[model samples]
Target: MNLVERDEQESELERIWSECGAGKGSVVLLEGSGGSGKTELLHQAAERARRGGGLVLHAGCSPAESALPFGVLGQLFSSVPAVEGPLARLQAPNSPLAAEAAPHDPARGAVAIGPQLALLLNEVTATLLELSAAKPVFIGVDTVRHADAQSLACLLYLVRRTGAARVMAVLTDDTAAHRSPFRTELLDQPHTRRVPLAPLAEAEITALLARQLERDEAERLAGEFHTLSGGNLLLLRALLEDHLACGGVRKDGYGRAVL
Candidate 1:
């Protein structure tokens, strides 16, 4: 779904990109309850990054998936191709894999994976820096509160080390749930910005309906929608869909429902 009206949030994201995309490290925290549009906001930011010719890496944290080791890292690795230069840089001079590698040697693969993971992360950071060398790189994470402990640790490492590289890491989470340790850590760090998302205002809701429905129809339903949704965007959208399905019609001036 298109983000209805969130100029403030959009501007905040743009600001992060502008300030941090210079190959300098930056972190942006977008905290809100479920259905508050945080994920949509991140999606918008990712689009911005793509337009600027920057690579985008996306990972979502889930309770069930968190237990899987290297879940996030695995996702990241699969998204981007291997960085040969970075891998070479990571290999030790005396390492066996550094000497020669058989095509399908599992042992050699195991020996290389550890250092390669480190190098890969560094290369990812470098790639972000390279993309933002003239513009900015955008890294987006959703449902961060559900992120695995390992991913959280790596994120913390990124926050601490990313300043020299131009990368903006945007993390979103449902604030109503248990607070994320990563969120707390990011807040404590320097150069991190936090934005809390609340429900939409009545006028915004009105504008949204106007875009979705006829003016008169929107006007007739606006008040009732506001009453039903209390400006909550998710609830409002769901309620509207439900209303349409239930044969709810637009009311005329006298408040009579016209089928």
Candidate 2:
């Protein structure tokens, strides 16, 4: 998307990068509608952190995996070095789901045992501290609203303890969905920032069309697509791809797209 009209969001992410490097870990909740480039911005920020010698961990939440305990957390830590043991112990012991859960998510049992939860939380804190002790760590989660309960709890726990560690937790979720109590609680945390990405303006869409087509065609497509996709970049790109694939480039003199 080339990050069109995302200056404020981009700047905040850059600030997060700087703060994470300075050992003042931060959490940023990026809120946006679909096609608003929330995930793309996070990916760019992760790339920046990686280029600056930070270890990057990413987890993508989905409905199918929401019921599994610690499912999202495992996706995050399993990629980092030497954290497998702790990740394996995330599921509650003696729970039926524990036996049936995948190997990566030992805490798959729905029921939570107090001691087991404590152990898992402690392990998470210890592992993150150790990982960030030597270098910066960037943890990014996309569609975090669907994150499993156990994982969300551990994330909230870790977030509360990140002040002195060299870590940055970047989470993205849609704004239109039913509000999650966890998100409301997360917003109240200290050292956390919520950045919202707004919809693109008509001119921004025009400029994007200008980048892809000639002057006359750009004007035509910009006007046509602003209506077609309502200034949504993702949808606009998809429409263009479809237009090209179906040989819809031939336009009338009045500049209407020929079907």
Candidate 3:
């Protein structure tokens, strides 16, 4: 995608990424509808952090595995060699010894924190925080609405404790779906910044088309494309490709892409 109408959002992310390197941590939530480019914007931010010598840990969540305990958290830490011991402990299957170690809240009972979850959350947070002592750490999670409960808990714990450290967590949420309670809590924090990504305008659509076609042809097609796609980049790109592939026709390409 061309990133045609996201200059302001990109500038904001650059500022936040720079601040992360200066020992000021903040949470950035990329809120958008499907195909509004949240994931692309997130990758751009992560690349910026990486270029600044920041330790970038990235993860993408899946709805199919949302019930799997600590799935997203495990993905983030799995790449780090230093946290292997704690990561191994977390990756191991459920056992009675681990179950007995977690202290439950008296009023809430055993289901409140789950068995051994609190300990794992603390260990991961502590490890990441300690790592940030030497350099900036960037944690990016995409499609966070589908993150597992335990992973969300650990993320919330780490985010709440990031005030004084060089640790930044960038997350993308699909606004079309129901927002997770944990994700909502993250956005409510004072240091959290929300970047709401919107669909592209007609002019931006024209520009995108102009990338491949002539200016006159792009201008001529922009309105119909915009009307059909509602300015969604993903749909627009597919339509363009279909148009080109089908000898410049828009016969059922969008529907096929949607399918």
Candidate 4:
């Protein structure tokens, strides 16, 4: 879907992407509520980075695989051959970064992340930094709130050390979700920029409708559509689909579905 009322956000993202290509790495957090277009903006940003000659590594995180160690990391490097060297060892059976490799403090009887994890984090970070030496790298992860603990650690490490490299990491998270300490730390980084997204405005909704229907008809339905969808782009699109399919908005059909 085409973005509406997001020119400023796009411009900011373009600026960040340009700076990343200029060897000024930074982190971007797209924060928004559900159906607020965070994922769409993230994909658009990744496409922009890719078109700008950056090596784009994009992955989506979910609650289903949140417990799978290094799940997000695997998704990121699985398709990129350039960074496969370090990822090979990380994914190998019984590798140092394996789940069992987490250090157990026998004295304190608590699991402590010792040198093993640190080395692995540095190895992954080094791989990206090294790749950036040749070309800019863009790491885009969606729904970081659901990223596994280990992958989140790797991302956090990279975010802290990306200041001088030609690398940019863009992550999206639902503002309504619980903010983990790892996410908090990542957002606290000096170079991190937070972009908060809200639902579309009435005028933007009307503009969106105008793209699909005649201008007068779009204007006629904009108020009711906005009221039903509460300016949510996703819901608004569904309502539009219903209107197109049924020849009008039926409160018992898509209207009820959206509600």
Candidate 1, residue 158: Cα displacement in angstroms equals 0.7
TM-score of each: 0.73, 0.81, 0.86, 0.88
| CA-lDDT, candidates in order | 0.66, 0.76, 0.79, 0.79
Clashes of each: 4, 3, 0, 0
Query: Model 4, 60-126: lDDT tens per residue?
Result: 9998997666789989888777667777777777676756333243222223345767776677778
- Per-residue error at 204 for model 3, in Å? 1.7
Report lDDT (Cα) of residue 28, candidate 2: 93
The sequence of per-residue lDDT tens digits that candidate 2 reaches over residues 193-240 is 889877667677767666666767766676777776666667767766
Top candidate (TM-score): 4
Global CA lDDT computed for model 4: 0.79
Where in model 2 is the C-alpha error above 4 Å?
5-7, 92-115, 215-220, 242-259
Better of 1 and 3 by lDDT: 3
Q: State the displacement of the C-alpha of residue 61, model 3, in Å, after optimal TM-score superposition.
A: 0.9
Task: Encode model 1's per-residue lDDT on 1-259: one tens digit a residue.
Answer: 4565677888878777766655556788888777788888999998887887777778888889864444564454445454445434334355443322222333222112245455555665565445556655567888876665545655666667776666788888777866445566678988787888887777777777887688888877888877766677777777666666665733341133211
After superposition, the stretches of candidate 3 with alpha carbons farther than 4 Å from their true spots are 95-120, 256-259
Select the stronger candidate by TM-score from 2 and 3. 3
Candidate 3's TM-score reads 0.86
Cα RMSDs, all models:
8.9, 5.7, 3.8, 3.6
